[model samples]
Target: MSPFDPFVHVIDHPLVQHKLTLMRQKTASTTSFRTLLNELAMLMAYEVTRDMPTQEIQIDTPLETMTGRVIDGKKLALVSILRAGTGILDGFLSVVPGARVGHIGLYRDPTTLQAVEYYFKMPKEMEVRDVVVVDPMLATGHSAIAAITRIKATRPKSIKFVCLLTCPEGVKALREAHPDVHIFTAAIDRQLNSHGYILPGLGDAGDRIFGTQ
Candidate 1:
């Protein structure tokens, strides 16, 4: 894809859009926000796993035996990128209950505005499984990029990125950094402000979800 073209999936289903509108409002309460985030995460997960492989097997019904299809190979890996990512983890897990959970804790360096990894843990035999990395915001793309970069070292069968909101700049940054990774987002805002926050976007997701700010 060209620099101007990023492989991004924007979930625009009516229900998703409606919940996203609620999420973008400043007056939305933490309880409501958390609930909406979870709902949206589950919806987005549906789109992300659309291409998952499935295999056919024989099954027995009360009346007769029949063929059935089930998810193929190893279970998917759900890796949350720290505090904010955890917000979406539960939602994602709701849909993929059998998915393996992992966490990569990264904090931004105030001075450099770069991501610094604090902790990283993942499921065993990562190379044999598909991975979906979750984070609520892709503002600067630094944390997502850093987290994905580290995850790539494990050589998974495939990898995809998921977020609640992102801007054009962030999409371009991440696409350029990891061209092979597909991105799925609920909405794409206009741009990031001077402070690295999406304009007309919901404020700090971690703080909002945890009622810390």
Candidate 2:
């Protein structure tokens, strides 16, 4: 995988790479695909939240009192990009159970390859919470871009985008559109197909995760 952009972080942990290879296999079952995606998300969550602010407080330990660091201020907001994003959301929530959840429903128009939003909802007090947008693929970047554009209206403290896979086109499009937002992905594939799907990607993430294909 090539470095597409500075703001795009390609997670290269051994485990992350291993699981991504498994997910890319053509014969991987729906059960395995979904399971692997959740596990992958959990592993990626570590890097995603690495810079989260923390506050120190004195706490009682088993042996004695000591200063402990905890997440500062309000809980994070994990916004899922509808059905496909829910797969990643599950793993992220398992890591940060106290996080507030939100959803943005969008679908790609096959003819125009544009994102059409049908639903949008978010937790209250977004201004106080850092937002992490989760989706499995960033093929065309349409859905991710549109979703983030709407979320910006709420004015969250910060924003990050997480996807299982992406291509140079996707990364460039998103970076050009939202330079302030960082992107985290397991791999950046060769390129996108004519239909706006990532080449060598693990097929349609939503369809594979749901066994719809």
Candidate 3:
């Protein structure tokens, strides 16, 4: 994937697009929003894990012996950025129940709009595992950049980012900051509003998920 184009994968599967349309509606209920987010996250996981390493092994079927392929890399580490990330985490875990999980608590600073890290914990031996960072929105890209920068410090074998929605500005910011990381999203919305919220986004994902606001 060239930095010129950025390795951003936009999921256009009909189900994904249809769910995203539901998510963007201002009238979507909190329960419905949460459900759609989880469904979309599970769909996105299929694409994210598309390139995972695999190895073939001989297996005995009920009728005959056969060779089959199974995922062959280190157990994946699903790193959730915070409260909203947990929503995606639920779906990702359903797809990879054996994978480990980590959490990084970073909230956007109201004044500077920069990421402020408060909590971080990850599985051991990061250098041997592939990590996928999960968050619902890549609004300003500051949180993704900051989270990956921290994860990169641990020298993981590779890293990828997944989100439900993003914008061109957010994509450009993340690509410029971390060219090595690939981004996967359901849709790239129009732009960020003045207050840094994604245009036509599903509103505050955490609040929608948890009914906080």
Candidate 4:
């Protein structure tokens, strides 16, 4: 029942750690925030993709009997969980240059606090791809769960969840709803506050990214 034990991986690469420090500080400028997110995203993508399959092909160059390599089947689909998730998309794409992209938008109902999907868009043949669902913050995990549920409808070959920061409660909720998901994160914070924000979180991710408040 330890929600933290299942499929959570904290990517602590030196590059990830370094960029995360800049991302957490008060002195980090808006432009700096963007740059850090992009850097961390690319670094995170490197670890997230380590288990991918590869294939070998025989090739002939100036010499003979040379073998080359390439990835196997089902190209990746990067599904952004909307708004804040968009910040990491470009960086991920920069690494997985051939990966497809998708978008899912969900809003929490005020009274129920349940996620309600307002929009979704995916690649034309998304069902055959390996999907990486991304969000910047995993606070309550309501939106992440709902977004994954929606994507599952497309019947992709695999699903992996990626977030910049994950809270314990959010990880629990996500694990319960989608046990097969492999979660990749930079750090796991503690619990959530009464307001549903992750304790010691970087504040509203959308607000911070957009300078809304």
Candidate 5:
């Protein structure tokens, strides 16, 4: 829970916090950074999907009959916000391999600091599936905002935005733009720097995850 916005969820589990600290270190290698991101995503997935509905069914065990509760993974959709999002996407897939995946390609315009969409695609029957948009950073919120706005047009059953790091400005902007969409993140740092980057934050998640830097 964030004071800035009630819709924002800060996942500060010990494991999440620990890995995040490692990822934030400038000395961390590309290989280690990428690994931590995926592992963090997987850990966060448990809490993100905590509210999912489950149904119990009777099953025959080795020695006796028992009832087991299960969730329908097919009812969920993972929409990655392009290249960086794919890192988080991989972890989520490991948790729910049956989930349908989608992609929305967006890049920030360096000068104006706005999001520019280059590509967009989603699974069929999005209106009936719960969508979780994955991205590593929510700095300006431009990319997440634009991606969610477009996804809303499809009228999905529900939508939740997941990111690794974010700042006050980014969270505020996103909450204002889409109050209905709940935001989940590992940590919320101090603020954004002049170039629209989260300060005291992990640098360019996309770059680090893919070794682009």
Candidate 6:
């Protein structure tokens, strides 16, 4: 297996690209947007979890016995970064059916431009599980860095970060704060807008996906 670098996997699979093309269009409906995001997340999970450890198990066929596959050692737990992260969770759950779930909610402190958590619930044995914290957009990555810091407090054996879209600032932030993590995304946009949104980003993922905007 390859040693994980500052891992960043951009899903360029054909199906994902086809769906993303539609997603990036100006007229894509909110319904399609949400659906695509979910679908893309599931597809991304396949690659993101490709390196998950596995074990051999004995299985009996209708007529014969054979060895089968089972997950090795540790199980996975997903930490949704709240609001938009919940959106990614739904899709991740579809693919990672057996993974445990955690939720961390942080509201940005307007004055400090930092994230302050108001809610956090994680697996009791988080240190024994492979944890992945997810969010849809990584504009400034301050929120992600905070979320990761809090999760690390639980001492998980390992942590991976996933996002749908990201900008350079966000990527840099995560790299600086948590270089041990693996990051997966559909695309990393060129830059952040004046107000901190990713340029050409689909807009507030929570708002667009939930029809709040």
Angstrom error of the Cα, residue 203, model 5: value is 0.7
The Cα local distance difference test for each model comes to 0.90, 0.93, 0.91, 0.85, 0.93, 0.84
Error of 6 at 91 (Å): 1.0
C-alpha lDDT (0 to 100) for residue 60 of candidate 1? 95
lDDT of 2: 0.93
Pairs that clash in candidate 4:
none
For candidate 3, what is the lDDT? 0.91
What are the per-model numbers of colliding residue pairs? 0, 0, 0, 0, 0, 0
Expressed as tens digits, the lDDT of each residue in 28-110 for candidate 1 is 99999999999999888889999998889999999999999998434699999989998899998888788898899998887
- Model 5 backbone overlap count: 0
- Give the range where candidate 4 is weakest over 10 consecutive residues by summed lDDT: 1-10
In model 2, the clashing pairs are none
lDDT of 6 at 159: 91
Query: lDDT per residue, candidate 6, 1-213, as tens digits?
Result: 122434777777898878777877768888998999899889888888888888888999999999988773338999998888987898988987889999999876766667888999997888789998999888888999999999999999889999888877888888888889888888878898777888887777887788786
lDDT of 6 at 60: 95
Give candidate 5 misplaced runs (Cα > 4 Å): 1-4
- Model 6 lDDT vs. the true structure? 0.84
Instruction: Write out the backbone clash pairs for model 1.
Output: none
TM-score of each: 0.95, 0.97, 0.95, 0.91, 0.97, 0.92
